[model samples]
Target: MSRDAASRPARERLLDAAGELFYESGIAATGVDAVLARARVSPATLYAHFSGKDGLVAANLERRFRQWRDVWDEVLDERTDPVDRLLSVFDAVVRYRAVEGNRRGCAFLAAAVELPPGHPGRQWLAADSRLLTERLHDLAEAAGAGDPTGIADGLLALYDGALARLARQAATPGLDTGDPLHRARRMAADWLAGRVPPGRPSG
Candidate 1:
């Protein structure tokens, strides 16, 4: 480890190492030894801070959820149009991915695929899904959609589809496909406008 990395707290260093490695490679593919080697901390230190690899995985998911929420909150705060605010989740994803240098896809979704049925990491994935579904429902209602649940679920599907496309793009960089998030947002906007009434806040 470099002098700068060495100076940081063990927990932070461990998380930094684990987050990158788990996201870049499959979580199941990344071993605790790899995280320890990258963090330059003893196995005892890792246990003291996070119990084990499962705990560390949970911690990473929680941290990612917080970051995602903060980014989405910022996007909502910046926009006032009801339609724009409703569609801001996509915008938040765009900004978050760029800032975090994440090219694969949604971390929570990735974790969901890798973690076993009863793993604690699944809680954070559920929490992330709840936030998207509940917030989109609320925003859709505020945007004057006749069927808030339907609209919210529709957008949620689009969001998931975009993330899948993102993973494909990352896997094949030369595919020449455009931004999935942008395309998803545009589709949402167009669909929302049609769903919302004439006098209401249409896209």
Candidate 2:
């Protein structure tokens, strides 16, 4: 970091550095020294603000969750129709990914996959995703799906599948592909139209 960059508050600087490095390089690959170097903070400053590297990683994930929610909530708020709100959720990801240059895919998904099993950060990712699905369930119910939870499940699949493949789609041009989001939207519309079975539980 330059002298001017070093002048920022330590915590903010640490988060900013972690965000960039963790996204650019996987979290495991990024070490505390790299983040400290970018933030131009001493080890004591980092340890003071965060529990340690693990805490810093957790903080970065939480920061990303808030950023995503802010964008998604703003779009959802604009949309009053329950079905439109559900579709807006998917569109929010599309729009945000575009702003991200469609690189790096979903940060939460990335973090979850990259983190070792039994990691608290992995659970944090799951919890955040569950909250999103619950919101989807509310919309699916209001939109009159025979099985709102089932609809939420279907849409959640579409949401994650599209996100997981976007980078690949952009990379592989000869895959006879169409817009993933458009496909997901159409499939979601199928669920709403009762063309696609909701596959609700029988128990």
Candidate 3:
């Protein structure tokens, strides 16, 4: 089928359904049949677009990356101050988390853990992480951080740690859960204000 004429709507519908189901329920637990049923498409139509469940999963991951990039671009556009722009990334994360029914942790990390290191999805995750890290580095440089790469690494670490903590807290009740994004924002702002030392370069 041609790219333009292919069952694009069905494909997108499948991707949307997969993202919702896979994130809410574990990817391993969601089957292709369920995805097709949710998308209201037959197995034949789905197969024409994707190789199988794996292909669908990869497509869903790519869709998420696109969504994230779009949001990041919008946030960056809203802030002219580089420091605020950099911190806006965390703000986006917090806003996303605050949305109802957002129980899934990092989708890329979840997919990577489910698949082996050499899996195609793992490869995509690695590439996506590198691109994100580079973007953060560039943003840090623009923000006048003393060491762009080191600051980028520090910010990434903080983000990953915050996400991990949030996921854990989401699982437990009455845990005195603090807002990771706010904590991260305060840390980033302090660093920007020169109150704390910039992180050392990783060897």
TM-score of each: 0.95, 0.83, 0.83
Tens digit of per-residue lDDT, candidate 1, span 91-134: 99999988899979888878888899999889999999999999
Q: Model 3, 41-146: lDDT tens per residue?
A: 8999888998888888878888777777777777777777666766777877766556424764677777876876565566568777986799888877766667
State the lDDT of candidate 2 residue by residue for 1-203, as single tens digits: 77777787999999989988888787989999999998988999999998998889888888777777788888877776556776887888877766655454677877877888776677679768777889888777666666888888888898888777765665566754667777888777766765223443211
Rank by TM-score (best first): 1, 3, 2
For the record, the alpha-carbon RMSD of candidate 1 to the native fold, in angstroms, is 1.9
Error of 2 at 24 (Å): 1.3
Collision pairs in model 1: none
Candidate with more favorable, higher TM-score: 1 or 2: 1
Evaluation by TM-score, superior candidate among 1 and 3: 1
* lDDT of candidates 1 onward, in order: 0.90, 0.78, 0.74
Provide C-alpha RMSD values for all models, in order: 1.9, 4.9, 5.8
Residue 168 of candidate 1: its Cα lDDT? 85
Q: In terms of TM-score, which candidate is strongest? A: 1
